[model samples]
Target chain A: MALDYALLVLAAPASGHSSLTAVRFARALLARGHSLQRVFFLDNGTLTGLAAAVTPQDEHSPLQQWAQLAEEHQTELILCISSALKRGLLDSTEATRHERPGATVHPAFELGGLGLLVEAAQTADRLVTFG
Target chain B: MTAAARKSILVVSRHAHPGSSLPRSALDTALAAAAFDQPVALLFQGEGVLQLLSEQDSRAAGVRNLRKVLDSLPLYEIETLHVDAAAAAAFGLDRDALPAGAEWLDAAGIRALLARHDHVLGF
Candidate 1:
């Protein structure tokens, strides 16, 4: 049986090939019958949580891809609050707190503390980082 | 603890000094894990070993003084620090050149150590 595991995807959506590599790896894991406990986004990876980001017309949007994957797998997509705030990737709660005009965080991702990342690293059967 | 119940966390540091500030992220994560009394071990390889150098002037880099952050590890009960021997040599450093607390491990040692950890997170 495939081991149930967790993955920490740490690449920004627009950050060259590593971003696509992470997405492809996620799909491969599922196809091999593994499941992710959560997909933790940190540092520039938090940019993937932005709902307003627009990819090139000719390119696929990893943000949309991530949302679709999370929906299909029922995986928790967590973006680190500190990293997100620094990069201006704000969810509704954060947008309201910062008095921003509109919430920028995609609904598929949730804003959380880095502690969640720690928890995932400590408890998950496997934690792989991308970036 | 049973095979499934034991908690082991590996924190990987891959960034170098004065160029990127990933050590701060690694240290912060270590502190957070240590706060929970988790058995967290740090593995420094590649440029990440630069973080272990005893002498560094973050003032020149105008960074957040990650050296000070690393010095606080033991206070939080996080003491396991590992450095890849090859990585250290590649950076022109030996175990003695690193800070007093870090332990050196070879490539095979690194692989074995990683196998012991339940989860691994690279910063």
Candidate 2:
């Protein structure tokens, strides 16, 4: 039977291939008919939502693939609000309040609290993290 | 937070205090799981064992005292704590010098323990 999977991506883009591998794992699970409950980004993983990141040609950018996965499969992409704010990743609403430049987090990702993590932990059959 | 659905979780904390907030955050996560009655085990490896040193004084550095939080783990129903033996030794920490309750685990022991958990979270 197909199981619910929660993929928690915790590595920064510069830190080796963890984030890329996470995206690949997500794709493989989806291909095999597993249900992706959500992809929760924490710490440096939130950088994946930074819209201004430009990947050089000949390189595979999992950040872009994460956005694409959300678009195609409607997967929930959540970044911890506290971690995001601390890292200076501000959405438009937060930008207006903080008076900083608006952040690059794509519209496909939502800034949420750690409570969502608890929910995922409670409901998902499997919780996998890559960092 | 009913007790019936608690998952078996292993939390591997890999950083130090006064530099990274992850150790405290990992504690909070463990506390949350404990509050929900999840069976949780905490393992301190790498620089994470530094949080367990006796003279930490993290508060003077403007960070919350992770050592204090760790002391309260039992109150939160989280009593299983482990320290990586090799990591501790590499950091020049003697097993007897650690806090009163944490057990020691070697690399193989840590791996075997992790294999038994339904979920493993690293910091």
Candidate 3:
């Protein structure tokens, strides 16, 4: 039987392979027919939601890959609201609320509270963390 | 959710305080789980035991005092706190040196705690 999976990503793409590993793992599991309940970004992991981040032409962009995964698979990509705000990542709603100059959150992701992470823990068959 | 439907979560914090963000993140996760009524357990291993130090002054580090968060554990109903005995001793911390209400676990006890939870998050 296919298991329901939720991922907690704590490593930033710039610092380590943990975020990339999580993306690949997500793809692999989804390919095997497992249901991805959500991918919650926390701490530095919220950096993945930077739509303005420009990747070098030669490198594989984990950012693009993540966005594509959400576009293709209809996956829920959520950034921890507290972590995201602290890291200066804002969606349009958050930007307006916080009076920020602009929003940096990618369209594929939504800013949510830690309660969503708790909900995932309670509901998902597997809760995985990468940091 | 029914009792059987509620998944138990184990957060294994394995980083040191002051230098890294993982320790705080791990505790936030544990608190969030507890807030949602999920049975949550927190395990401090490796350098993570340093976070339980009662005398840490966050002002010096320019970070929020994690001791404050530790103190709020009871309020969140997250009572199951485990500290690796060897890790604490390695850092020269005695029982009274850290926060109260934390249970000391040996290697085997750590293994059992990992096995008891439905999901384990290592930070």
Which numbered prediction scores highest in TM-score against the true structure?
3
Q: Sort every candidate by DockQ, greatest first.
A: 3, 1, 2
Report every candidate's CA lDDT.
0.80, 0.82, 0.89
Residue-level error in angstroms, candidate 2, position A15: 2.9
Q: Which candidate is the best by lDDT?
A: 3
Per-residue CA lDDT of model 1 for B16-86, tens digit only, reads 86577466666767777777667788999998988887777878766766667777777877676788989
Summarize candidate 2's per-residue lDDT along A1-131 as a digit string, tens digits: 89999987788765789988998899899999999979888877777777777888888876788889999888999987877787777788888888886765778788887777777887888999897
Model 3, B1-123: lDDT tens digits are: 678899888999999887898888888888888877889999999999988888888897688888789978988888757999999989988797666679999999989999999999988
DockQ of each: 0.51, 0.50, 0.85
Q: What share of the true interface contacts does each candidate keep?
A: 0.53, 0.41, 0.88
Q: TM-scores, in order shown?
A: 0.89, 0.85, 0.97
For model 2 chain B, where is the 10-residue window of minimal lDDT?
B54-63
Would candidate 2 be rated incorrect, acceptable, medium or high by CAPRI criteria? Answer: medium
Better of 1 and 3 by TM-score: 3
Better of 1 and 3 by lDDT: 3
Comparison by TM-score, 2 against 3, better one: 3
Q: Model 3: which docking level applies?
A: high
Clashes (candidate 2): 0
Candidate 1 residues lying further than 4 Å off, grouped into runs, are: B1-4, B94-97
